[model samples]
Target: MSQSASDQSDRTSPVKTQSPLILDSLPDIPGVEDCSLRVQQKIDLILLAIEALELGGSEYMLATAKELELQSIVDNRVALWRMRCSNPWRRSHVRTRLTLKQGKALTLIASYRARQLTVLIRQLLVAQQQIQEKGLPLEQHFRLSDYLERFRAHFRSRMNPRRAKVAVYLADENQLNDLALSLLSQLLFCTGTYGLKRLWVSLFDGEVA
Candidate 1:
């Protein structure tokens, strides 16, 4: 059988095999325990975007957590759901707080997955760039189109549209697409050498003094 684009890209990429990411030795950020709501939302959204890109994303998160011995933080599927539901925009919003430990677990899982999907992420971003330079609609790129479509569907179904913030995205497709693209960019960043640390610190952007 012919290799798929993602497969071909992965084969051609220069990533070297490495050990799993372990956060046990790293000291927790000072303000991570007091993470703001926006930080929680951003972290969940980035994971959600990954779910949109890859099939069985939820399962993969669970598997990756166990592989990295982070199951203590991520635990079962319900635990993961509740963590993600901490996002204010979730239709099933729970007023729970995400601790620094839990946040780091999810961050590690996301970063690991991002590294695995680096080739595909780069391809999609490049496709978006080329399409825009040619003044072509995003749908002109099949893989990117599929990813954006899945992202929009996931967002519409999971988010509370009645919420003023989510309502704005519902009202404007372009804004939503831009958000999807932005998340794609962030995932690309997570594929970098210092991506894990960078993303972790970024979660505390404004919340930290």
Candidate 2:
């Protein structure tokens, strides 16, 4: 039996369908608790990015303003968007996304997270510099936190530890420590962690295969 032209058209014609671009998203990270507090979380992430990039005072405010096309950061601060508001603006917002008593939280967390990451990064970069220049002095003799703290105190004046925030980002990416641990604790995690302890325990047990 010959099929009708209608049948042929129905079978051969491409299905007209479209997938709307999926721009709006909140990373469904397992342990992070998103609630009324999520706005603060987003702001905190942005502040870390700002601090890591060394965007200071007006520069920080201006970057957010320009990226979001707001007249000023005061505007940005008020018209909060969804998605993690972070730097390198491309990664900050979703296409169409949507806050809480978020106003107060945003202000507070922004300053707090920025200062926190700044110090953490300054510490990490100091550690990295020491490793490269002198080849890991005192690492074998001291736990990482104790050593890094002493190193920071050794410097007479504040070094502009403004550098890429790889250290902070690395801690998050690595699933290291836990949320309970402070960011500094996460950074200075070369010793005193379960993972490090396990590694040390295995040191003499097996020969190189």
Candidate 1 residue-wise lDDT at 205 = 77
TM-score list, all predictions:
0.87, 0.25
Q: What is the lDDT of candidate 2?
A: 0.33
| Candidate 1 local lDDT, 74-146, one digit each (tens) | 6699989999999999999999888666777788899999998899999999999999999999999999999
Candidates' C-alpha lDDT: 0.84, 0.33
Best by lDDT: 1
- Name the regions of candidate 2 deviating beyond 4 angstroms: 1-35, 38-42, 45-49, 52-58, 70-209
Candidate 2: lDDT of 110? 40
Q: What is the lDDT of residue 42 in candidate 2?
A: 32
Winner by TM-score: 1
* TM-score of predicted structure 1: 0.87
For residues 97-121, what per-residue lDDT tens digits would candidate 2 score against the true structure?
A: 2221123223333433344345555
